[model samples]
Target: MDKAKHFERSQDTAHDQACDPGRRALLTRAAAMSAASAMLGAGGWTALPAWAADTAKPAAAGEAAVRQGVWRDQKRLRDVPWRLRLPAGEKPVALVVFSHGLGGSLDGGTEWAQAWADAGIATLHLQHAGSDRAIWSGGLAAVKAAASAEQLIDRGHDVQFAVEQLLQLQKSGDAAWARVRPDALGMSGHSFGAQTTLAVAGRDFQMRSAPDLSESRFKAFAAFSPSAGHFPGGIKGITRPMLCLTGSLDGNPLGQERDGRYRRAVYDTLPAGAKALLWLEGADHMTFGGGGERGAGFGQRLLGRERDGAPEKLAAHHAAVIKTITTDWWRWRLLEDEGAIARLKAPKGLNADDEWLQG
Candidate 1:
């Protein structure tokens, strides 16, 4: 099936759940909180205050709910924006730090973080100044002009810095942060951010020198629509379980091919027993974000482009599905939720789908 048709069918299958008024409300609320938290004050825009331990609540209807707010990354250059969501409870099973693609921000994939939050996991969406697409395009001309390897190195530091700050917050008994199991920490990102995740997870992307892994953290990693330009020499020496997700409709055909080649290279090189690749059919790079016609249209407008039709709708549907799968994957890997894993690994088996499993 063509991309448009495939997305339409996926939309039809997901329509009921995705359009639920409650779910939509939840997403809106999360978005609003994220925005509000960002604008509250210097601290609000920069970093999250200690979470109140007593503020935890249980998920309504057994669904994980997101807590929208900002977190301060002291290491962030110029205090970038951040969004965090956590399951309503005192005990968080695990923490996942989510990084956005080049030219994207915390808002790019807030819903994905919400899904993880709803699944009883805590998620942090960090917006890095040097690597964010907006910053790259509008503010940091020099960094934007840097070689792809340098860009990856810069982004990798952003991820590493964010993780370090979070760890510090956890160690400092911040009330806003529910103590997370350090060993269960996971990292995920899209495009450039994806490559950063790999670099931070003890993998050398050949973009720059390998980061010091002994001080490196994160038990698992997920990369969505990752760019492979930085992987000139391929990923090597990654022992952590990794998950790489992609879409059939990702633009920049060259980037997509490179992403796939490096992903396979890393997967093939990794020792057996702890890695997976999921390629969603009829989906594009934007699918991992807000995959609705409206959201896609808005994204295009932000990029100063004219609006299109089927592509927008298809993109939105892809976003919803990606959100679902992301939650499932993190739940399985970090929370040890076997049921979610089974669902994620199982095929929907409908037309226009692609998924591969390797060791």
Candidate 2:
């Protein structure tokens, strides 16, 4: 099937969902509150279950553990607009690029980037021109309709272009992204950004049976809220250590596929070793990406009404868990942190809020 045809059908399916009044009617006030209750635990501060593999007392402590003992600064590349998350003190051991989901910006990736910086690693939060939040200045409708096959292809080009510029800057002794270990590079993204990461990691769409756009420079990968069943031929050449994160509520609300399980296909299809998946019980799609209003509001759009999310305090806890997991994965994959390996491997120390699977 031609990718253009696939994209047209996808848009039609999504637009159909938007036009269905029956679906909108089902998302009443009662349903909104129920959905909120299902997502948010007691007092709206949804408490996390005791992690069997992680004995960390509170989510804040774990957040602190990942955020502590590291000095960092955020800088902007002159023309690129890429957010540079450079750890203070010594040179970084590795570099990681974080691409935000469709209609997302650099801020969406700040939490994870900070966690990586805290671990003494560098992170680049790439901002895309055509697909970022600028497209949503009107409202959610634009966001849903903003993505196109051309924009999708451009997203991948953006990643490759940013990597080249960064490497060239380092070579010129800019000292910002200097000392980044070429062997330990990492790539991560959320939602549409995950699609971008997949392209850079060697998932060949074979659009018209075209060539793949895998960037060998990326040695490790991570994704949040990635839609499955889109990439044909699966991940043909991706073999790097990978971490796929999602919540029980994560899925396509506008499309027919609403189950979170569908999102796991990437993890299921990746080559065996060094691959891991973290499923946060009761977590909605927005939780993994930590979208302030966008994350919370997308749920409302999904349900066809305006519904608030878990309490602010409770939501923050979930975001913290996401940060901890990403930082730990990067640690093990890029810097060879033994503690991260122990944490990732600890079968007995599981958090009640998080269900982990490894392959």
Candidate 1 lDDT by residue in tens digits, 1-359: 33222211111100001112222333343455456546654452244455322233445865554444344443232354555566666775688887776566666566666667766778777766654544434433332332233344445655665666677667887655545777778988765566567667665422222234222567788876554332223354666778877655554321223123433344555557787776656555556543211222233345554433434666555555666776777778787888877886664542355666647
lDDT per residue for candidate 2 within 1-359, as digits (tens), equals: 55534333221111122211222222342354456556654342221122112222222422322111111111111122466666656454688888887667767666677677777778777767667768667566665655554455546666765676666656666445466677788998877777677667776554343333478888789987665454434563467777888766665645555446767777887778778888876665566665532532353465585322542335666767777778888888887889988987763334586688898
Off by over 4 Å in 2: 1-80, 138-141, 208-211, 230-232, 256-258, 291-314, 347-349
C-alpha-based local distance difference test score of model 2:
0.60
Q: What is the TM-score of each predicted model, taking all chains together?
A: 0.67, 0.73
| Residue 341 in candidate 1, Cα distance off native in Å | 3.7
Candidate RMSDs in order? 13.1, 14.9
Task: At residue 239, give the lDDT of candidate 2.
Answer: 71
Measured with C-alpha atoms, the lDDT of residue 319 in candidate 1 is 56
- Alpha carbon deviation, residue 14, candidate 2 (Å): 12
